[model samples]
Target: MTAQTGYQDHKTDRLARLRRVESQVRGVTRMAAEDRQYIDVLTQINAATHTVQEVALGLPDDHT
Candidate 1:
């Protein structure tokens, strides 16, 4: 594929990952609002954190 095509595809993938992270945050918010168990909410928060970190870490590699 062409360079621009590859970049567009990667950008699309990154956007999708970010959207998933957004949904994860929303879920966490809902859980907190509903007074979910502390451990459960904490677990989801950790998951969201990890997902965002993964996306961030991939950014440098994408530039390379």
Candidate 2:
């Protein structure tokens, strides 16, 4: 699903969303470093993965 238009107006919003995903990834790294329980770490990893996927999927929609 390629977007036919550019997201010029949504640049700020898209960047903000990416920043949030980056933060989520950092949190996951911290959890692992802190020796968190396996399930807890896995849960956070899943959440981060889902967030990234959402952002990726939104790109084409937003551009359109």
Clashing pairs in 1: none
lDDT of 2 by residue, 1-64 (tens): 8654566677777787778878988988998999999899888778878877876787788666
How well does candidate 1 match the true structure in TM-score terms? 0.81
lDDT of 1 by residue, 1-64 (tens): 6445334547877888889889999999999999999999999889888988987888777666
Instruction: List residue ranges in candidate 2 displaced over 4 A.
Output: 1-5
For model 2, the run of ten residues with the poorest summed lDDT: 2-11
TM-score of each: 0.81, 0.73
lDDT of 1: 0.84
Off by over 4 Å in 1: 1-9
lDDT of each: 0.84, 0.80
- Screening candidate 2 with a backbone cut-off below 3 angstroms (N, C-alpha, C), the clashing residue pairs are none
- Span of ten consecutive residues with least summed lDDT in model 1: 1-10
Candidate that would win on lDDT: 1
Instruction: Please report the TM-score between candidate 2 and the true structure.
Output: 0.73
